[model samples]
Target: MEYHPEPVQQLILCCSCGIAIPPNPANMCENCIRNEVDITEGIPKQGTIHFCRNCGRYLQPPNYWLSCELESRELLALCVRKLRGLSKVRLIDAGFIWTEPHSRRIKVKLTIQKEVFANTILQQQFQVEFTVANQQCDDCDRVMAKNTWKAVVQVRQKVSHKRTFLYLEQLILKHRAFKNTTNIKEVRDGIDFYFAQRNHAIKMVEFFQAVVPVRSKSSERLISTDIRNNTSNYKFTYSVEIMPICREDLVCLPVKLARSLGNIHPLVLCHRVGNTVSILDPNTLDAAEIQSAAFWNNPFSPLMNSRELTEFYVLDVEPLGPTRGKLMLADVTVARASDLGTNDTTFLVRSHLGHLLNSGDHCLGYDLTTCNFNNDQFDQLDAGRIPDVVIVKKHYPGRRKKTKRRTWKLKTLTKEQDELVARKQDLKRIEQDYELFLRDLEEDPELRANINLYKADDARSVMTNGGTDMDETETDFPEVQLHELMNELDINDEPDEAMQ
Candidate 1:
């Protein structure tokens, strides 16, 4: 080969000195190559087989046993990200794998697939899970704050680290605590930022409603509102099957009011940060605590005896479960008027709070003896009574020890007499209408085409003329009894002869 010196630009430089090396293949200076080979010599290339979709490890980590935990974490994380976006999250083990009844957070466990050692391929194939959680915030890596979310996850088999499993489990706990703490800090900071400088007030208020859900039964008045300004002064009396929400999700809130845009409650702060929630309103707390009908009638006091407690109001809520599973709907209100005598009322209301159903469910403390009377009209219709609905006022004795006037609200308490008035009014209107129809029929032969008029007349006639004898015309139904008592009404003879 003609050895014309190659252009200097193509020359290789020595790592030791700035001198150019020969123009051979990958021409590092001979000194640099020798040094690299010496440093690289005798190092064993260790590799792992099992690869997790999450940690990408062949071996599963401890405390990541239940698939439910993993699922809840992933799901809660994802949900938080979507709704609140990159929010801090807290996850606590309610000590059991089953979802906590009153928990608003999803619960899941991590899953580990078995490792299939492939002798044919000459490498062990560690099959791991790529399972993501549902109902969780994936981006935020936190759980949700629903009333309850119970999800379970079962792995293929046991983990290999039997020796250090206990230690790892503690580590997991620490991690969870840290996560909850950090989240709480972020939430508090966010609250400060979110509710920053604004008009000053002695104390701003927030509302918290307690809702009970029952699978069966329906009501019209499902929601009732009670506003509370003081949260630190009182706590909601929520009964649970297991444990109630603790300091983690419910922290002691500050006395000074932080400015807010009124978009969300401050109680959500603990939920956002450390699983510690600070509820804002006093009135809402009172209402939520009064889940027990007994409590509603007589304010729970350490000093007052049961006999000393005021008048009665029993909630006919869903039956209590073995534990706190039976939750009373918190939305329904006591419809009786305070001015009315003991348990004397025309109608009561059943209002909704958090959900559509006015009934309680198997989860929390729901008053079982109280019957919410939205209005008797709906029930009356089913009982085969006349169709008319109206609210009647009633009074109840003083609920507070000091106040004596009374509390008054609408209730659906209808006596047979009340219903009778409704029926009689309905019948009288129909009779007048029928009388007009007959006159019109006589006036215009073209009106004969109206079969509806005939049907209505026939139905009304049958209702009035129960028997062939004209004396049987006014037989009594449920609504008629009250009218008879009040008005001394008598049943006239049946008017079948009039039909003839």
Candidate 2:
């Protein structure tokens, strides 16, 4: 089958070395545009563009979109909601809250997958084995630990090694929120974007509340999205007191709510009497204002704004992007649709991303154990410290009695694997040395040793040391004695002239 390229639209384009922006005719994005900025008095130098989502700096190949920092259970829950958005994003009837980002880590023999029973059914989980020389941190990255997982949880889903491979058939991309506002300093994750001291979202909410004209409810306004002169326009009536949503309340929603909205602000409005909400953009809405619109315009605004209402939370569990409706990683095409806000509550996904994020691929997940390292430790090219699995939970029930069996796998480093890894490291070192050796030969011929430096995958084409052309074979010279040449003539002339 021929693969057809999807037409490009509002795709965020990044040059090889800058913060990405929406593509421009210049064959570059904003980072490139900023490069053209005329510098006068000490503008800060641009830093490299690193994607907020995953390991890759840009939204490039191989590295999937950033996975949610949230656990697989929560991730799966998010994925399910995104899938369900195909119909509508009604409040989820079932709320399977995941533990915190940091879960407990347990060390166990990982040769065979561990099987455990949850509610008399089988489930699968993963345990990653990590070793640290007892290095301690004041802030442990390990959310789960020895005491953290004292009691095993029977996650509702069953995941198998084979199934893990199966689920990877498509990538369950992580979601990222891109703030297109000109103010970089004000841009922040989730709630932080709102409540900024100098932002307009708060004041705007207050102003909106003051203008609402509610016929029956005193300054209250009712808004109906009906056609005006054959044009779709929001009809409005008004009310009193725009009770904005508090910051703490918005953050309480699961991470999936953000993902469901395509990392865009959620449209969290209440259809009480008046008001509408949209996402922040170069063109419109303050995401920080979502709760404001919902609170000020709703008939239940008074009840919701009371400190007592703090007990309940409302979050838009859909990604906020431009599409018919979905959260796909594929770029947005239509420019106008790119600016959906928290009030719109409509998320759009690309077909490619839509297919990849489907529950079939990233459905159930088992977590790896803990690692003892700082988050900043990965700056160098060294192998990243692998954290062991603190705990794992299956997302669903197994198909059969055997498949229903709960299992967790944690593999210990074997003598062979450990040795192979060491050898690979050695190989890397050798390669570096070889490059230096070649540089020495090129810069100063006298530095050349008795070796033909040619193309060798290892380092150089030395006849000895297992070079590519000739595999070193001590066996070829059977009569040669190992280390028997201490008195060899090669050193005979070295000290003779100097000592005499």
Candidate 3:
């Protein structure tokens, strides 16, 4: 192959400045072109940034408010996007400039590149000063004006205790169902969730319907109306009444309903309360579900609750070997723990918790023999067929005066307390209900599956100090596995000082 050398092209003179430059369409020097054609001419050097002092959010034009730190990429992007003609030039680089926090000013340095002439590119840098202006967003304005909510969801359960409500709150927090709620208020027997939009409230109601059996009715109050525009402003209220049934409650089903549910007994224990009420017959170990519609159509209250449970000492337990899941039918002879020293009042009964019970174990039961009946169904039942004692569950002894902190913790929503002062007895009852709920979480693995259990801050210390009081019979206490708990991360809300 023959070696060849390329000839050097001749340089042309600048038309306007009379300087040598590469051949191009404009026929001008780089300095002259830069002076004549300014790419950042229309882009503003100073602009105003609308910020909500209350929420610490920056307003995006039109009607969107966003949360961003002082010198974050989000804030830098917001500043860059506000310029009118920045799109005309290609953005090479953009960053934040440090400024005093009290000055209410954000400075952004932008480097842009643009083609000024044929085969010629011009790059330039400019600083944009954005003064933070105080502005209240629509949501904040409504809150300050005391008309903050467009819709409210009132969740209530007509029960003696707040256990069901507390469980529902945990479910809500786990699924982030209250993320859209503007405010949460705790009432005597229920919770009120306020939303800024009707759709949010509707979504919340749907969530309640999916998680538990609930009967809801909605009503709206007209706030104002515009006749010419055919527009009316109204506040909507969704009264969602949860099923009265709760876990551990004894329900006395109607004779007709009981026959319909696979020939189950009228007296059944509520094993679980979810989208449907799960009831199990302690005598037959037959389980059935009562849907929301079915339950409301034939409304029934709990014949008895945990408050009515009496501690009984199991003298004997003989399993019949008939099994249904974890339950087994057994004949048990029990004597009331309270009457152990006073009298020998022993009663024979059949229970489904035979798989977990043993001789000499303590259990909670209902003493139907001495209780007076008020319902027609109870009066109709044959006196001989009804058991004298019905064991509910195994009783774990050694509960401390002050609750021992657990290795795991649960996240709860921030709620406003009722205006009326809570009675001392009511507060004590609430505490007892909470303690019972915690015990349920420990014993029921399926129940805790839906919840996010975080590792407590002092978990190691508590564990070292004996996390829970141990009973002589260790099998009675169910411990939660450590692996199932997640370490809680602390999120910082303040802007990073080193970002500058």
The top-ranked prediction according to TM-score is 3
Model 2 residue 328 CA deviation (Å) reads 6.0
Query: Residue by residue across 472-491, what tens digits does model 2's lDDT show?
Result: 43223111122221222233
Candidate 2 root-mean-square deviation in Å: 40.4
**Candidate 2 at 13: error in angstroms?**
82
Runs in model 2 with CA error above 4 Å?
Answer: 1-294, 299-322, 325-356, 359-500
Question: Which residues of candidate 3, in runs, are more than 4 Å off?
Answer: 1-30, 36-48, 59-74, 77-103, 112-123, 137-148, 222-233, 341-343, 400-404, 460-476, 486-500
Model 1 poorest ten-residue lDDT run: 200-209
Single out the weakest 10-residue window by summed lDDT for candidate 2.
169-178
Over 222-331, each residue of candidate 1 has an lDDT whose tens digit, in order, gives 13344574322211111111012211122112112212223222221111101122222211221111122322332211111111122223233332122212212232
Candidate 3 lDDT, 368-396, residue by residue in tens: 87888788777777677788877888887
Q: What TM-score, to 2 decimals, does candidate 1 have?
A: 0.15
TM-score of each predicted structure versus truth: 0.15, 0.12, 0.81
Candidate 1, position 337, lDDT: 31
TM-score of 3: 0.81
Q: For candidate 2, give the lDDT of residue 268.
A: 27
